[model samples]
Target: MPRRVSLPSADDLFRPTSPDGSDRSPGEAAERPAEQAVDQPADQPVHGARPAPRRPSGRVRHDEKMTVYVTSEELHDLEQARLTLRRTGLTVDRGRLVRAAIALALAGYEQDGEDSALVQRLRDA
Candidate 1:
């Protein structure tokens, strides 16, 4: 059996370490200018006006898990494809490439379903 390893949490990865083993909160790390601070008066608009809207956070919305199985050779092919795409000036990782291919395939399948309607209309004409 393969030995299992536990992954560290994001907090553990970014947590500050002191020589004496003390922890520092994230807010204590550094301060910005008053104009740059989120809570500062200058950072807010006058007359209670709202700032420009921001994009919805691209973070995962659910605590869901998935398991996928791939052979070593398949994984190597994926890595090679990722490298090739990077060399061509299109920055893409294996996961992104896979997701894009899946999306394309789904779109093609939907279009295939509509092909019969077009074929029947052509035959009627």
Candidate 2:
């Protein structure tokens, strides 16, 4: 007879942090029966605002895949930009550069709406 082995599920593999942001194991801190008073900084986010930027790492884990087509000139420009960035001592792949650019554009649009550079460029095209 073969023995059975139990494996962790996806949710167990990627469990989220607790609401209070502590790394303590579950049940280590007794669950509060009532709302607890917390002293937060004046600049703390009010729930709707975007979260802070993540630390830069050479690799990013992506579960979903996307396909983007670029012209020969655009590909050349991207490679040149990659080389220029490499010369600056910050090593990053083309996908990371594209993702960072998208994040900046989205942030600008969120801040300035219609007057953002992203909006202007899209409207012009």
Q: Identify the candidate with maximal lDDT.
A: 2
lDDT of 2 by residue, 32-92 (tens): 3344324354334569876454333234345456899999999999989999999999888
Residue 104 CA displacement from its true place in model 1, Å: 0.9
What ranges in model 2 sit over 4 Å off? 1-58
Q: Which ten residues in a row have the lowest lDDT in candidate 1?
A: 53-62
lDDT tens digits, residues 1-125, model 1? 99989999998886545444333444753654565445544324457575333222122222334567989998999899989989999887665677665555544444565565544556787
**For model 1, what is the error of residue 19's alpha carbon versus the real structure, in angstroms, after optimal superposition?**
38
Clashes of each: 0, 0
Q: What is the lDDT of residue 122 in candidate 1?
A: 60
lDDT score of model 2?
0.70
